[model samples]
Target: MSSSGTPTPWSYAFIRLLFRFVLKIFYGSIVVEGTHNIPKTGRPCIVCANHSNSLTDALLLVTSIPPKDRNMLRLTAKATQFGQRTFTSWLIESAGTVPIKRRKDYVEGSVDNTDIMQHLMEALELGDAICLFPEGMSRYHPTIAPLKTGVARLVSDVLTRNRNNPDFEISVLNCSVTYMHRQHFRSDVLVSFHPPMTFSPKTHPELLAPIDYNNIRLLTTQMHEQISSGTIDSPSWDLVRVAKLAARIYAPLGTRMSLGDHVRVVRAFLEAFKAAEDGPEVDGEHPEEDEKTPAETAELAQLRLDLRTYQDQLARWGIKDDRIRRQPLPRHTILSRIIVRLTWSLCLFSISFPGLMLWVPVFLTTFYAVHNFKKTGPIFDTWDEIAQYKLIYGLMSGLCVWFGSAVVTFPFTVVTFLLVPALMWMTLRWLEDAVSAFRAFSALVRLLLVGKPTLRAMHVRREDLHARVMRLAVETLRLPEDSEAYFARHGGKEKGRVRGPWESGSRYFSIKRRRKRDWNETLRLYDVVDYPKE
Candidate 1:
């Protein structure tokens, strides 16, 4: 058995490189911000992040560390993940995971975490960066869950043990990972790091004085706030979906907003909503409770109803608000574009038909396995389960294809072994591209043929509601109505000015800009009662 403070083996480093390569190929992009916040080398550090996606969260945290700061990141996983088989156990062990018996895995009060803490303390003392999820388990909700005290306890123990060593210091860093769409393939991720926080045994003796409960609670609260900062803590995916659509409608027509921009707007709106629901805090200048008048409350309820109706209408149309906002062309023009896109897609498919056919079985098996897993997996575990299952199934299927191809070509030459794997990979790549092209073509067809009239009406209603919401934000929220500021904050440039729908060539207006400012400051306008208000 490997000791706790042992240096990372060569095998772990090799596997980490392979993991990074696979993540780069799997995720469309992983944008890292605030890299400077990572503590300098030579001291122990603990990285605490919100846990949402299962294995992907740990994978990203380890991979995002710069090469200079790179070391074995010792991660904690449930004992079940370590597996019972020798081969599986060896694979997980070699990857630098510390297995712990979780509370859920045992009867109440029976689980003991002393060994886990000991292992973590030893690793930290040896200067390894330790990554652990404070939330304990992955969640489906947008906001951070009430954190378990394990992290706080770990920090406490480490600080207590190293107090006599003058040169030893420990820092805890907050990392927040936001996914564009967690369950969707090829979606983007933003990993934001906050400045490291240090707790000294000298400053707060209670941290080390017999495992003080009050001190631990305070520390845990601080960690929770830091981790939750700048993250989208939505109540549910449905509200997120609504917020996204509303944001698209709230923007100037024809603007092609990037996914990051969309998420920013959604997050801003959620924040605003939270502030509104909380009312004003008790300051000397404000009332203890800034109670809303009955009339105002009624008006707000009506507005929410309208928004929900709009969301349902969007669902029925089979199109997203952003798609409508981006492609504001006439019916005839949209039809023409669909035809052109379909023709291009058909041409590519024809060219890739041979490769597609060869890879079809592998793709089908992988897809079916992922779909069934999603259907049967626990709701909160959906993303993690799908990601792990897909990766394993894909590798297994690839090997099967390679071996089959090699056998068929074996009579020709020994070179078939290498050639077959390369060919199989190429075929899979072509099939993936072909499928993407087909999906795009199909979406365009749906918009033009099935959703034409509904989309036209939705566009008008979206514009009107957007104007009303902006008015509410300005008058009620006391937010500014600065178009330039909104565009600047959203990372978009204003093209021209807003124009009336009746204006000439309005059907295909420049998605670039609008002249008139609809409303100004962004607001979080989603419902509060459905999901925990925060």
Candidate 2:
């Protein structure tokens, strides 16, 4: 950081590239959208996102933005992070993080953020971008927690600063980051940047006063609405699980979806569930529409039951959902596929063997890191923490070991350091293929051991369940029954389109209640704002 407590340009660039490289190593794929929505450096910007994964969320947000603006992007972290005595804390400080104390992180009247607020204001005055998670804390959950008012408060303060200078503007970008499996190694991630939510003292005068509690509350509510729309917001993990299963079954056999498309389908299912439970009010006059409602409701209930049963059966046999085929493959075809997969894996393994040998120290460093994490008093607790520890420890320690060796073996130092990362990448690819091949081989063994009648019965049950799921989804989501048609209509070459039930302003799908009960009470016990009773 420079003397002004902002990240120097070169330091910021180096850190940004380092993060990008680590991300490439960690996640299998990273899909970023809406880069054009990022605000220019001339304006003060606030990049707010939903927090699900712990440290990686921040790393993803920083790397998703354009490189030119990254040097000016100052990330806001929790005060607790600043107080930590670790290498991560040192890096956070050097990266010019503005630390603010949360109410929950401290006892009442223990500490104040007066100084932090002043520092943030100073950074904004220079048109530096500020990024933070409005949820206040990172979590491992399905639904987004109720957002804290920090974002609104900060915007109000910035607006107050710009009251006298009408030319100055503030841009708030809601960049929601989603993960396929947050804890899994080599999972996919999607970072989407929504259009900037701009504010100016001249236009939004009501928000200019820092002490305007009403306006601040309204702004926070608006921010939550926008952020929620971009996330996979549901009531519970159970709902998320069911929705994902339903989406998978709804697709055609051998169909694969990109991360964005998968997120859209899952969220749509979640929203449909919410809408069905809410059961919109309808006049008693329309008998035909009324009769259709209960039949669809019954169909959904049956679908859920079948899905749960199938899930339990798969669990019993230690089989994955994706391994279930609608039609059993010919024996020769299955055997040939398995043979080809193992042959390819073996060839790649041979190629990566030498590189792995050269990076023995790095492997040893990672082993130690894992051992430390498994201790009784481990520093890391969650999956995100463990993954981050492995990455950080491996990079830092590997570099130190290589640098020390380079001094003694002076001639080939540059080539040695350069070769390590390439070797690491090659090893990663070989491991992925080897694991996939092993799974295929295991599935093949199961097929051979299990009798044909039992396997055929399972296949028949899956096809029936899939058909039911698609039929229900078509009625509720208002999409074509055929998977290809749905994809062609909404899944464009670029952005994945998601149409909400109410997007068309149609009341046809909204069913009248057969029974009266409050659905909002059934929601998860998170801090989310209450939904109105239908």
Candidate 3:
């Protein structure tokens, strides 16, 4: 590693490749959008993002960038992490992570971070992209926290130092990382990059002086808003879960909505509810003596209660809304359905048996270690637990599989060492595939027999409630009947095409071509607000 916090070319390339491979294996799918917003090559830019997942957040952001734009990327982490363990410090150092003492550390009489600050400034001066999580620390929060002023200070320092250099420019780019099922293996992740917020020296030469308190606050708030724009900032995870299910049910049947689209629609519904709650009255007249009528208040309350109830029922039944939505009641007779399920179960069992035998020990050991570790430690947040479990389990089990197999087969021949490790690796891959197959089989059994009637009833009730809510939204909000008209007015249109904020380059991730219709269908389904016609 170079002394100035920038990685040597070879080390950078190696670490980048390693991270890509590891992320690919850990996450079932990773979707990235708005890559076009990142300049292929340009002046140093600060990439700011929300912090939730521990080390995984940094890894995802770094890997998501295109290789051409990724080479110059440098990341920062809390200094305490480097001090805790030799392995961690070495790993982060190898990846070119700069360590800075946090405010708490300063209070504890830790050495000043002037050297670290110099390292960062030097890296930026060399035109390297740097990523920082403005939240200062990771937690299991559903929304972004109050941002620290470190980012603002760094930007100010860099820009002020280079004020006389017209050719040098600094920009702050907003990125958001949304996990579909965080803490679960094989979960999906969506990484989105938004357009850069440029701060040109020529345009604002007065910023050459040291940044003041007000300017730092203003800059931090602006960056926070930009980063938070792409994320669904909910009050609670339960609310988010309920909102997603409601969005899915309200969405037209047979339409395939991407997880990102599902999240966007959920956020919109939450926003609408918030707006209604804050509004003085539903209409000009109040049904009650107060601003809120009894009926209107009751309906809103019931809506929330029903959503929570539905979520509880789904959890109790150990089934998800998607499974019910995708695999609706089969048109076959009971006997035929039974036979089909049995056949599928047998097929899955046959494929998964060998891998299960080989990998069961590793899986069980990792699971036990994670749970026990959590119990012994200071309360671990969700993402922290996930990061710890994944890192420990992945390293420990991987080593066991590679070396244990070699030791066991040593008597056979020298070639047995290489062959055994290869075989073990292949078995691990097969185990992942088997786990997916088994989950599908389990879901099918639940849908077809275990809770079929209950699912059907819930689906019916969900549809009814959705319809009632839509009607309520229309009446209370005075929404337009035709969604296209609403879209045309609120969303900018060109050549008969309407673009909502979700489609903005700096707002949200875009869906694939095949799923584009699904997103549009969802928008149409919930486009209840009325805006004045142009």
Task: Find the candidate with the highest lDDT and give its number.
Answer: 2
For every model shown, what is its TM-score relative to the native structure? 0.78, 0.81, 0.76
Q: In candidate 1, how many Å is residue 231 off?
A: 2.5
What range of 10 consecutive residues in model 2 has the weakest lDDT sum?
Answer: 513-522
Write one digit per residue (lDDT tens) for candidate 2, span 1-534.
122324456656677788888776666667787899987665678889998777778888888888665456788777788868898897788777778787777876677888887887778777778887888887556778898887888888888877998887888899888876554455567788888899988988888763768888888888888888876887766566667677767764334344566677777777766555545447555455434476566666566667767876765665555567546667887788878877866776687687666567766887687677657442223444655676777778767765766665669878867765566666765655555556556666666666567878998898888777776678757656777556656554322233455632232111210110110011111111112121
After the best TM-score superposition of candidate 3, give how far the Cα of residue 396 lies from its true spot, in angstroms.
Answer: 4.3
Residue runs of model 1 more than 4 Å from their true location after superposition: 1-6, 86-89, 203-206, 251-262, 274-304, 326-328, 371-377, 381-383, 402-456, 469-534
- CA displacement after TM-score superposition, residue 362 of candidate 1 (Å): 3.8
Candidates 1 and 2 compared by TM-score, better number:
2
lDDT of 3 by residue, 1-534 (tens): 121324346776776677787676566557687888885444577898888788888878877888766455788988877756565566678777889777766786756779988888888777678888888887766768899988888878888888877866777888988775555554567787989877767876645675457887888888887777677676656556555655555554323344454456567666555433465565767555446555666666677678778766665655555555443666364346556655654664576576456567666877777777667645325445565467547756766765776678767657766765455445544444334444445555556665567667777876777676566446654444444344444422211232455545322122211112222111111111111121
lDDT of 1 by residue, 1-534 (tens): 122344667877776786676565455456677788886555678899998887778878878888566456778778877867654355567787888787777765688878778988887887777888989887666768899988888888888897776556678888888876554444467788889887666765677848759888999999898877757776555455555544545554334333345456666656555544455455556564455555665665556567778777655644445555543667787778777777766775676676665567666877898888778766665745566555556656766776777678768546877876555545544444454455556656667766557666777877777777777656665444653356545543222223456542442232211221211111111111122222
Whole-structure CA lDDT of model 1:
0.64
What TM-score number comes out for model 3? Answer: 0.76
lDDT of each: 0.64, 0.67, 0.63
State each candidate's clash count. Answer: 10, 0, 0
